[model samples]
Target: MVNIALGASLSTVILTVPVMEAISLYTGQPFIMAMTSVQTVMVTITLIVAAINLNDGQTNAIEGMTHFVLFATFVMLTVLGL
Candidate 1:
């Protein structure tokens, strides 16, 4: 589970900054960090919620649903660019 988490996080999100910087330099264009304030808040809240859910070394549908709902809200806000 730890390996899976690390692999998934590194593969998907960890390279964003360097890759985007390289692309910006190559193209001579500026690119934003790709994370909005809403994204930041979502991540913060997710971490808190994950801790709450995992504090007992187990998780359930309610905890999962909390995460899912938060993710959905984040996606909706992102899609609307708000």
Candidate 2:
């Protein structure tokens, strides 16, 4: 409810961190993020872009396009399986 009170829309994405940690513990396999993968690279870039773009509490077409391009590239890489 803190997110609701704060009017923050980022809670959904933030919640996944703990949920994933709990899932890893429950499964006992311990999820590990491979640092040398395409997804990792995309995720890192996305986070950096998001931090820079969203830092001022506003968004624009350029910011949206950046994310779309990153997603498209990630999808293309996934389809090629490399």
Q: Residue-wise lDDT of candidate 2 within 8-65, one digit each (tens)? A: 5455557866788789999897777554487887889888998999999999999999
| RMSD after CA superposition, every candidate | 4.1, 5.1
Expressed as tens digits, the lDDT of each residue in 10-70 for candidate 1 is 8767687688888999999988767988899888999999898999999889888999999
Q: Number of the top candidate by TM-score? A: 2
lDDT of 2 at 16: 68
Q: Which ten residues in a row have the lowest lDDT in candidate 1?
A: 9-18
Please list all clashing residue pairs in model 2, or write none if there are none.
none
Instruction: Score candidate 1 by lDDT.
Output: 0.88
| Model 2, position 75: C-alpha lDDT score | 86
